[model samples]
Target chain A: MSDTKPLVDVRDLKEYFPIHTGWGRTLPLKAVDGVSFTIKPGETLGLVGESGCGKTTVGRTLLHLYKPTGGEFYFDGELVTEKNMPSLRKQMQMVFQDPYSSLNPRMTVEDIIGEPLDVHHLYSGRAERREKILSLMETVGLNAEHATRYAHEFSGGQRQRIGIARALAVNPRFIVCDEPVSALDVSIQAQVVNMFEDLREKLGVAYLFIAHDLLIVHHISDRIAVMYLGRIVEIADANELNNNPIHPYSISLLSAVPIPDPRIARSKQRIIPEGEIPSPLHKPSGCAFRTRCPYATERCAAECPELTERSDGHLVACFNK
Target chain B: MSDTTPKKAPFSMQIDPALFEPATAEEKKQQEVMSESTTFLKDSMKKLMRNPLAVFSIVVLAFILIVIIVAPLVVPYGYSEILKYNGMKDKTAMNLAPFQYSANEQKYMAENGVTLFPHIFGTDELSRDYFIRVVYGTRVSLAVGFFASLIVLVIGVLYGSISGYCGGRVDLIMMRIVDVIYSLPDMLVIILLSVVLKELLDGSKGIIARLGTNMVSIFIVFGMLYWVGMARLVRGQILSVKENEYVLAAKSIGTSSPRIIRRHILPNCLSVIIITTALQIPSAIFTESFLSFIGLGVAAPMPSLGSLANAARQGMQSYPYKLMFPALMICLIVLALNLLGDGLRDALDPKLRK
Candidate 1:
């Protein structure tokens, strides 16, 4: 995978929100603090974390929806900046988590999908625009008859499909699938996930799939990165991380994934952590998981751990691992 | 197992591959039980049609519009022209009763072999036909209401969309300016502007001279002060609508800021804008009438409903019907507009829809 250049390379991305702490003072809530990852062409990199761990923020910042406080984003070896964001946006797109809110309620399905085409002037004329929209809708498994209908008329799964069609309108090289199936039914999630996989195979598009569903992430990802608090603690191949997690947080997380067989489920050792996840507003010093870690040492609190290669293609950030 | 006795076949766990085949076009078409497609506007219009009160209001407004338009053509009397017979001022026509002809008009008709039009709502103190004046008054008031609201709509939508979409420091400063405008006394501004504009536009002819300084000042005041309400409303709406994931989706797709507001945010805010504009018309009409009542509306000889009512105030005891005519017209217009506005609010507001 390293032979081909990475389609998206994010380095030391930091996004801080200044929240008013009252009394004429403010504090920087470190939502995403120096998180970094890279996606090779046509690869799916799954980002898993608890709620409010900046999973969505990472996706948004990469797309320049919310300007990153500090970071360097290289897309196809070209540095993405404010000056070039409009042009670079053509190569990247995003599928939001919520199906209902992600589509403009006022717009018809045809208009929704054609918006990107209109913005980029991608089509030759009206007929070509219509043809492009219909083809895109068909690609996402939407009916041609459903084009003129408003967003409110569609079901949740169909709405998500329309959103997907809209994302695919520009033929983007990379997409940020931010919990795309999180707001869907279990039955529908499978269909959408399968469609995503099919599109990746057919179109050769890369994805930054952010979701907390470990099973879904494991099922679709080529590589998986485990995040704790605002930092990534472990990253490795999906099967390798699932079978042999190095970080304690990832260990606890994988242990929580339910097994189908009752025999294994009854015999499995559940490593429930000792404390609640610390608030990002006042993150703990040093290793964020140390307070909940079983093997917390004095050095763990004294210094923050850096991601180190434990084996081929496996990275862990911990002192006593 | 091979004996003649009924041998049970071994159970097979394998499923048929044919059942797993993709659905045919015929079957897929049957599965797609979708309703007829309708745009947002057409859907809203359907909902609006179902409302009987709104329908009735619409009919009444339509009837009133037709009456105002047609009455001028049929009445055969200019709004400001005094009643004259055989090219002479008919002094006896002053304060005549409804449908009555003056002694000179009767004599002149008898002599010239031509019958004259009677005063439909009686002649005013100035001997002008009151019905034509009333019709012209309705025209002036409706024009003011519509133009003023249009001015408010353009300025408010532009200002508010920019302020809300830009947000942060720009929004803060822009909103503070809106706050300052909101705090200013609207009535005082109208009076001051009218005083100044009357002098400045004194000799101007054509439409300006016809609208007069007072009407122009009222429109200016509406553009300046009245738009704050709409601006604040649109700002509040955009502030919330901008946070929706669709807006972020548009941004991620490289949609320009103006296009995002125009195609996405503004369309979502349409209900509020339509409702506010509908409601604004009545208020503007009322304000213009009130200003006219105080001798600050359209210039002299240009009859407005308020000025007509003011003229009728003196003859209240003797000719009570004079007051009734203009008063009833004003009431009907304002009430019809108010009802229409309410109906629009209920129809256009998606939150209020079933």
Candidate 2:
């Protein structure tokens, strides 16, 4: 991964949705505020956070699925702008969280998977298009016979595989996989994860894998970025971020992950942090996480810390860290 | 159910090879492929075909279609042609009963040694062939109903899609415009416009003159008054359909807004569109009949059912069946159309299907 430019580089991304309060007036819900990250080719960056922390929003914004209110993104060294989105989309794809709503119920599997090819005018003739669709089904571990079926005909895992096949249809270099496995059964989760790993090995595709499951994220990601209240508080190599978390929120979050061995897990101290996440509409001044942080000081209340690297490229946002 | 024998390999596989084998050919042959794929349209069509009432309605409508098309060709009398016998006028043929001939008609037939066809439904007050006039009236009324509804459909689909898809200030303004249209007294506006268009388009050479002053005015009224309901329905359908994630998926894939609306949004809203448009046809027909009954329908000499009914009302004390015949024709048409519309509504949306 050295000496090569990252395939996806996001700098100071902000996505705020306006809510109508009354009359003509409205207030902004700062869903993703000043977030930044990078993913090298063939790398997986796990994004983990509690629900409503804007993890899904980050994934969507990175792919321009939701237009960024303020930010600059570079895909393969080319700047991302609205004018170039049609071509840029060929390189970037997304696997949505809900297997149910993501696929159009009316369309056959072939049409759903072949949509990108149709939009791009990739195939010259009908025969070639059919062959490509069948091959894509084969690549995703779906039978060619299932190509003529619809989304409702499939189980949850099968539907996710269809969505994956659609994402890979364009032969994209990067994908925003937003909790692709969270909706499936635990028995099906490992099978899908192994497929992702194998596909990554075979195709050299990079992923921004967003989830609330820390164990799954730890198992798959080369690096991990933990989000809190629409901002990334810490990011480091997966093992380092899990074992030696520098920020208070990260330590607390990691404390919740139950170790598989019951003898050691029961003995582990769980931080059961107090208080609810403050509403993003009225975010706390200084550090957004300080209201929930145990080590928050007077100075911590006075200023927000920039995400600076402490050592060995482990970036944390707490001043005490 | 025989399984294929495993292929012989010199090297052992990492996992069992039998796991990948096609176990039984019965898996393929035990069931036939589904003959027809399930969809809102095909499923609804199946349901519609199975409904005896809908099928009967369609048959009645088709019979009307064929009769109107072929009746004038076979009938001997022009709708307005005054009958004559032996170089003299036969004024005694007024208000004759169905399948009856006057003494003058009989004398002409015997003198010529040729059979004069009896009036199939009888003559009117003008001694004109009532059967031929009724057929022509059916043609005109049916045409007016269908075209007016088409006008409503085109305008409504465009207005509703634009208002629903845009959804902010534009939607607010467009919906208010629809509301304004809805609240306006439609009959009063239609009457006033018909009076005005009757003056401007009577002899001025244009498409409206070809349709005559009354029919053109009726069309214009329909264009103005009928689209709001369809627009409101399409807007509601689109509002709900737009929330589905496939629309978002289409957007993320760089599909243009128009393409997304046409492909993703409209197809989902098709159930509503079909039901509304189907029902609108009969509404337009009923409105036309109401207008014609009030003496504002098709002009003189060009018969319409409502006008015929209006004409028959004066002779109702003596020739009551004259009123009954045209009135019965109107009822049959409206009823058939309404039943077909109901069937369409049931067939197009499976959510409402029993």
Worst 10 residues of 1 chain A by lDDT: A256-265
Indicate the worst ten consecutive residues by lDDT in candidate 2 chain B: B31-40
Error of 2 at B97 (Å): 3.7
Clashes of each: 0, 1
lDDT score, candidate 1, position B84 = 83
For model 2, how does the per-residue alpha-carbon lDDT over A1-321 read when each residue is reduced to its tens digit? 657899999999999999899998999999999999999999999999999999999988877777899989999899999888889888899998888888887677898899888888889999999999999888889988787767777788989999999889889999889999999998888888888898999999999999999999999999999999999999999999988998888898999998766668879999876799999998998899888878888888898888999878699998886
What DockQ does each candidate score versus the true complex, computed on alpha carbons? Answer: 0.72, 0.42
Candidate number with greatest TM-score: 1
Cα deviation of B64 in candidate 1 (Å)?
A: 2.6
- The per-residue C-alpha lDDT of model 1 at residue A266 equals 93
